[model samples]
Target: MDKANADFTPIFDGQTLAGWHAVPRLPVSRAPGGPEPDRTTETYRRAAQTTGSWTVEDGALTGRQDPPGCGYGGYLLSDGVYGDFELLFEACPDWPADTGILVRASALGSQGYQILLDHRRSGNIGGIYGNGIGGFHGINFTIDAEYDEQGRPIGLRLEDPATTIEPMTPDKTALLNDAASGEQFLSIWRWNEWNEFQIRVEGALPKITVHINGVKMTEIDTAAMKHPSYRQDEVLALLGPQGHIAFEVHDNDPGMGDARWGPNAACRWRNIRIREL
Candidate 1:
């Protein structure tokens, strides 16, 4: 309430998906070099045939892959575009769901700055990810989920080195200079419950800051950071000064031991409020 302190507005109506639309989740990882892949037509086609399901149930926006683990993913994006704003929302995802909140997103939901809400086994939350902008990860640690015999999520573990794919080295640490420790995040995060997320996105090339349950999680300055694959000029041109906000339902990879999204399970969102700066 304090950071995004005043003049807040509600983007979601709590009854329907009126001011939002669906789009296919596109490739967020691209190799450095060559002109950006123009997937406009492909994005449109996939959107028309989107297999993800979005609905408002009990006043909470719920999203899940249709037919439960059909390997399809999509994003529900706001119809209006915004620049330099503060967004607050509460999310409660089922175990094993790879989801996120995307800011500065293109119409097709291909490109954006993402706040990772990867609520799955050996996944992480509140991290900064470059969506279709070079695949840079700006986070200090990882989180792993513990499940009961019935396959329900029981608890969470912090910074499991064995499951880490991108370790925090000197370079990574320098790039993500304002990262919160894993223990700091774990101490505040409430498992299997509705957790509030507050995000501040500003500037042409944004400096994004994320807070979970009122605790600062991480901050990334795209304008100042450098990555092997990230091109600031290219991203600015592709996304422009303002764009839509989107929620993602990640594609299920059947090869993985568990579905990226659970079977018939949905991630719930509510109290989505925003304040434009």
Candidate 2:
């Protein structure tokens, strides 16, 4: 990728990667209660155990597939945490893989908001995960009981869970909005090809804007998003200042025997970059 006409200045150019350190890879299987590995070794170990495959080449990061027992592929880091910043990166998955850009992550716990990148046929892409929440795939709404002039339940309603919930279509453009109100900020699609992702984080009010080949897809209201048994404020607080970014690859095919151990099923990431807003 060329550096010309770049919106965000290049912080760590691929030519001479400075301030970025290469984390080592570690063994997948370890005996119970074994002596813990060194820092770099442990980082690689945790990544392999969690995401399945990740590698670096020519100063660019890439993810690949390894057997389930070889460790899950992803990044496990003790660095790269920011608050109220903008993150820009390019991701292209070879197969159906779920990748994410995480911010304000907790160093000691799995508590934070993740901008998901999933390519499944289902409309589950570009949602928040973790921080005591499992999944909030798309914009969902619930309407309180309507009241008439006599304070009785009215017949008219809008955007209700029983009948008003709908998924926003994908558009390739930037969007901005006040998080307090549930507004359509962005539309996202898991394109078959590479797409540029722009994530703007303004403290607890994080917004996600996605574009594909210069076409606007979607903008999501991070603060207004809600899920069952989870509070947005609590998750944001736990994210703290900084944390590691990772990718998640899971075995979805259940027909094949030992599908988890099968080959030809893995995810990859490239051209990763972040700019502090």
Candidate 3:
């Protein structure tokens, strides 16, 4: 394989997690228990008896959740913090899963810019979302300003008044897509197919830009975005210019009788390499 010319570095060792840590899927409890279990056992307990695992297979960093777990998604975070960098990786999902590349995350939580990988029917492959920022938190994405009937952005700092967001065209130098469902955009992405994702983070508050299979999706000037749920000060705090990189291991919703966490959602990530700019 060719190198990124020494600017980029490979983080995953293809077989082990030497410099990574897994955050507790759920908060620690003071429940009545027998002789505080070991850290690993405590984690499974925190996961509400459901086992979500991150491991290396086929030279990739893979995260899996089984038993439709009882906790929220957990992150496998890097031990070090990063700021002003470009990250590239490939992700493949086999089912309806919510996956993200977390950059500039705060400590152990999802406080940062997320490259949303909600590859379901109505999900987007390349989009900027604020993690743990109220209205933006936990939702697929954030929307503050309303759109006109023609999808023209009503109010945004960087948007032009004449054009709507839809029908957006990238530079002719980039690849093209045909639909919003992500699958119709190109053959590069599909269930179980490896889709290359590239993310760039810059500026003091960080302007997030995303690309999938070499096509630009959209960009978010974090400091300039407005939303009803969170104030700019609140949102600004969540955008960590220096933080860890992580892969989210999703938790299954425990429901029964057709309301289950079924349809089995799972994703795989590989070739996770990054370079600071």
Candidate-wise lDDT, in order: 0.81, 0.43, 0.58
lDDT of 1 by residue, 153-256 (tens): 69787746765644545665566658788789889888889999999998999999999998898888999999988899988998999999999888765355
Candidate numbers, best lDDT first, in rank order = 1, 3, 2
TM for every model, in the order presented, reads 0.89, 0.56, 0.68
Query: Clash number for every model?
Result: 1, 22, 0
Candidate 3: 10-residue stretch with minimal lDDT: 171-180
Q: Positional deviation of 157 in candidate 1, in angstroms?
A: 0.7
Candidate 3 segments whose C-alpha is farther than 4 A from its true place? 1-3, 27-51, 66-72, 137-184, 238-240, 254-265
Candidate 1 structure lDDT: 0.81
Who wins the TM-score comparison? 1
Q: Write the per-residue lDDT of candidate 3 for residues 1-277, one digit (tens) a residue.
A: 2336577787877789888877745432111121333556655565654336777888777766644443345778998788888888888764446667778877754566677775432334566555655324222122122357996434312223244222223421122222233223443444346878778888767777776777666566666655444355655555535788877765544332111112345578877788888
Positional deviation of 263 in candidate 2, in angstroms? Answer: 2.8
Better of 1 and 2 by lDDT: 1
Score candidate 2 by lDDT. Answer: 0.43
Residue-wise lDDT of candidate 2 within 122-160, one digit each (tens)?
Answer: 213344444323334442221223456996433222233
